[model samples]
Target: MTQPLAELDDVRARLDADLDEVTEPLAASALAEASDLAREYGRDWVDADRCPRLVRGLVARATARFVRNPDGYARSRSGDESVEWAEGAAGDGGVFYTEPEIRLIRSLAGRSDIHSVEVIAWGTRQTDRTGYIPVEDGKPFPYFADESEPW
Candidate 1:
């Protein structure tokens, strides 16, 4: 199997948590999931060893978020206190990359938003015997006065 982009140690560092039977396994699983997700988002273009630090950071951050809120809780409250999850939070108790993360992955994978194409326009001839006319500055070249046929 391919190596994970981020390691357990990476997740642990992000979470600032001590290793333990529970946290270790959870963090490891989260790291694996996050790495897999990043690879998939990159459409198999992402290399664990060759990926940028930002990619690794994304994996670590995603893993840490998953470990912290596995249930994908949007909010929690106790008595008068309340908590609300911000945008880009994990969803439905699953590991996921945020929008910005996905954009980064796409960019790294060479999927660009801007696109361009070259167009060649062969203008129609006034008649079959005439030479082919060419387009100039996006407009077809007008026929010379001598080239015009009598009405």
Candidate 2:
């Protein structure tokens, strides 16, 4: 069953509070462990959990608060439906950052000066089989081009 809006907000707040305490740079070994743990946690909620939370966690851990790109693969192929931070994963608490984004923050934070970062992502391209329902005319997810203008 779907939860009410307020219930979802509370979960997000809790997750935010949990993440704020990380300060000192985690060692590569530690980062690896953390990444593994993240993957496990995300996998538990496959239907509407793993990938979305993975993305949001990237944003949550970042120092530079960039705006989220409001686009991603959905459960089905044909729907134009999108997910915001709040109602993504089953227990996600509304996060919308990606693994690359998190690594970007750790790099900028000079985390390497102390210890390497430990990152464990939930999903990857090498073996993604999330049962994406095909969209209209049997089209797959749209190709996303990052912003780059010819100067």
Candidate 3:
């Protein structure tokens, strides 16, 4: 099932809150628009409870997967707290992806590019924490945090 058009407003609300936390005035509204789209289409693919978590997981997994580093340090020039947190949480053998990046994944739900296979690929990487996320592939996305990034 896909998310109803009404839920898009809620998604926008949440994204706005997140962006406000980061003081990113520009991306805040833009991401909120994307969030609206995510909330809309998410209904067609997953149930209500599953939709938000899926978005969070997809966003998390996307950051974890594509942003790998040989030294395990995701050198983000943006310096967003969310990105830094993911990096701080990772191990030397792991890669770090940002929360917003994962949020993008959440927004991708029910789209042609969004698929279980891609989500799995992102989630399967190992992390330092146990309950940071549900199991992905044979493992969970490694979640580590040295210090809380100031939002």
Candidate 4:
């Protein structure tokens, strides 16, 4: 029920073709599917109205790929001849954004695969403990010495 990110004209423009009745419907469905996917993946970070151009581009690219290969076949062979489909084309021939496109969306949405956190230990002094020894170095005057003592 949500609005499509791209229009039929956008898909047609990407395809560089004046879509016929049959292809038009297929393209329209593709646009809807692609738009929904973009909205779902970018719900956290993107305001659709604010970045219509990028969303539209993603929808168009995904829709075009789907319309071109609805069967989602990976390879076709005929008497020793074979045709290999493009990367996304082999997977259900469905509307899908490429890796780079997903990365762009994630970047726009302020998400990243790499993450970091500050680890803190309770009841311990907030100081750098790297290369520090309690008993041998005799630097601390808190807690039990046996905990830090070597066995």
Candidate 5:
């Protein structure tokens, strides 16, 4: 079922507050505009409760586009603290992520509402997390067998 448009006001308001947390002046306004864009686009594709998430994704996507150093915006937040990478022992080459993994992390990190960023290894049976995002195959965003080996 679809949600009514009036409810978007509250979501947008919350998004405005979230956008305020952004330090860059230009990025702040850009993120606000991105939220509006998400609202317009999501009215047809997403429900009310999911609108905030969609807006957050929109902000992430938009921020990924305008920023000079994309890595700077990829800090994932947990409670009051921000974590740049998920806590885990180092993988192959002692590198935490590959090029594609870095892009995915940065993309997901753009959202201000996320509490943490966790990359579940592809074959793992775990499914307790609520916001699991699947990775697409190939080139720019290749899925790795583990953090160390690209598939």
Candidate 6:
């Protein structure tokens, strides 16, 4: 059974507290390992004893991936082609790391030289066809000559 959202929040809160105090050199590495664990086991709920470890892992991986290569990762992350959330996709439910957590991780990981990492939030593409009106039904198709004008 999926754990209640409240439990997930509790885990998030604990992680936030932990990140505040993380300064050890090995913390990132250990959290990297914990990340693997969180990926496998954190979906429903992180076990209390393991919760801090897993949160650290989430922070570590998020920070590492962004810190190691900021521009390249940012470009890919913001692009429409990036892999997005989909049910039953391979390696889905591999932990939940929020933007706040990632930011905290970046600070704790000591990659202060790099100023920013851009990330585009994503979700599953809307699959329901209700939004798509059939052209064959003689519906007026909207068009704009200058596509760049919207921005």
TM-score on alpha carbons, each prediction: 0.65, 0.20, 0.22, 0.63, 0.25, 0.21
Which 10-residue window of candidate 6 scores lowest in summed lDDT?
A: 1-10
TM-score leader: 1
Local accuracy of candidate 4 as per-residue lDDT tens digits, 51-147 = 5477678878889878877777578899899777656434656778877887777676667879999876755655544555566566544445577
The models' CA-based lDDT, in order, is 0.75, 0.34, 0.40, 0.72, 0.42, 0.39
Instruction: Name the runs in model 1 displaced over 4 angstroms.
Output: 43-47, 79-89, 116-151
Candidate 2 achieves a global lDDT of 0.34
Indicate the residue-level lDDT of 101 in model 2: 53
Better of 1 and 3 by TM-score: 1
- Residue 27: error of model 4 in Å? 1.2
lDDT of 3 by residue, 63-140 (tens): 323232323444445556434223353544332335564345435553455456535465466544546566555444
Better of 2 and 3 by TM-score: 3
TM-score of 2: 0.20
Give the number of the best model, judged by lDDT.
1
TM for candidate 5 is: 0.25
Error of 2 at 53 (Å): 24
**Of 1 and 6, the candidate ranking higher by TM-score:** 1
Number of colliding residue pairs in model 1? 0
- Residue 66 miss distance in model 6 (angstroms): 22
lDDT of 6 by residue, 15-112 (tens): 43333333232334434443543434433234334345435445455434332332323233455677444333112333334556645544543434
In candidate 4, which residue pairs clash?
none
